[model samples]
Target: MSARNAMAAMLDELMGPKRNVELGKDTKVTFDDPDICKYYIVGFCPHDMFVNTKADLGACPRVHDDNLRLEYPKSDKFEKLGFEREFLKFLSRLDEDNQRRIRKNLEKLKANEENGQKKEDLRKLRDEQEIARIDGEIKLCMAEAEKAGEEGLVTKCQELVDKIEQLEKQKTAVEERLNNTATIPPPIDESAIKVMEVCEVCGSMLIKNDAQCRVEEHLSGKMHMGFSKIKVTIEELRFDNGSRGHLLMLLDISVNVKDGDHVNETDHVIEIGEGGLDRVHEIAIVAEVVRATDIVGMIVIGVTGTETIATDDIVAK
Candidate 1:
């Protein structure tokens, strides 16, 4: 929607209950009414995604009429509603914001990982020092036992030997504790509470490689669902815009297949349009040349040039 249109819609939607009555008395309802949410008309509204959650995009200030939404796709004004462009712009901003959040979250996780390792190292160091102290005490006791034995004090020497044995057992206990810290199991990053990471799309906390069930549960959650819907809708809107409201199976332009590079056979063609087959359009979304063969229902033609496709290779049902 245009800026002027959006402003007018916001004003009208925010009108007081009394003003709404007055407008109804003086105006008529139309699908193109400024108060209707264009995003909703296009498909799903982003505002509905995070209700009751931290990412909640509070209530939308515009009207969301189901009737209008249903009628929009079939409306004569469907082509270039401008709302689709606006929707794409809005989604792009959200995507950028989410990306920033992911970066920030990763920094936190990195810090947490460092702190966790430091804590473990410190613990192991303390344990090793305690064992060294015990060893030093045992060495002194052993020397005393040797001197006592040489002086013909058998009882004192036996006592020193028993004391050294107790110290050795105590040292063994500390060594076991140290070994536990150096084990292979993944330790909890107490700084982060427990291996927490950010969800790239929703910016919410997720356990790194969490249990499959928990992962599924998170994906199905309202916040994730909301962001996922926005992403899919944005893709559809871009596709519609590029194909001019027609669902055209265009080549994935990003592949960048060079000329005569052995165009590989496809399992299935990649489609990117949303229109019915009734529309009189017939261009295969493929590379600049050498289109898909055996198009059973439509004429397949090269989009970039009039490259010769075999007459017998294409048939229309």
Candidate 2:
């Protein structure tokens, strides 16, 4: 962690919940207190998740207490207090900022890929030209050695031979490098290519066809966790609503409609008799209608928040 972040964390400890309760002073703190961190009470705090990252939000300004967080759900207000909304709104803003950053990075990467390949081609062409020039020099030296040998200047001929040998070695090295540079790597699978995408949850730019472990690590990272927590909390609030009490059941319904005698839009009135009640065996909820009930008498109910519904089979608890 950076020095600044470390100090911020230290201050959070000294001045937050630790100061309020652990210091032995009588502190009458409640979950509803403005000083208490509501984000922590609802779930994970976004301020704590992004520390030392480019998205670092610094330390949470409010006090974080495990006791207070536990007490929050049991409070009279709970979801009515708007703590979840506040937390959701803040995280959403953070993600929005991150999405902009991700878009910029994508633009840069696209431009760089083209430019980088052009640079690589230029370098290869230069290396090839150097090898050709060196080969020409070697040929000239060989000609000189031939001329000197005819004149019986043995010493000069030998020096020319040595120079030609050195040039040949240089040419060989360049050719080897050129061959290696020209080599094509094995093709990657198309299925693997599709896996890489901008993470909608955390607004991160993931590597294209990254290693499995690295992808797993990214999925489990703090930023991902921070964003994923939003969905979990929303689901909790949804299920916590109706009388069925968050029940999940395996349902198989085949209904024959008789007549739509009366119209009750609040809950569909299913005339499927006693068998429907036995299958669900749970409290009731709300749903929509499919006109008259003759061949379509099934008033199948889907659970939704803050609405109470009744049917012949399922009763509101």
Best model per TM-score: 1
- Count of backbone collisions within predicted model 2: 2
In order, what lDDT does every prediction score? Answer: 0.63, 0.61
Which stretches of model 1 miss by more than 4 angstroms?
1-19, 23-25, 30-34, 153-155, 182-200, 208-211, 241-317
What does candidate 2's lDDT look like per residue over 1-317, in tens digits?
57886676566556654453655677677677776788888787778877776678887777677877887778766565657656656655675676687787777666766676787798789889999899889889999999999999999999999999899899988888778864533348544223345676676777777899998999998777766775555456444423121221112122333344454444334332232343233233222122212223345443224333445342221
RMSD of each: 9.8, 11.7
Model 2 lDDT, full chain set: 0.61
lDDT (10s digit) by residue, model 1, range 136-217 = 9999999999999999999999999999999999998898888875444553854344568888877777888789999999
Q: Give TM-scores for every candidate, taking all chains together and pairing residue i with residue i.
A: 0.63, 0.51
Off by over 4 Å in 2: 1-32, 52-54, 65-68, 74-76, 101-119, 149-154, 182-224, 227-317
Q: How far is candidate 1 from the true structure (C-alpha RMSD, Å)?
A: 9.8
**In candidate 2, which residue pairs clash?**
257-294, 258-294
Count of backbone clashes for each model? 6, 2
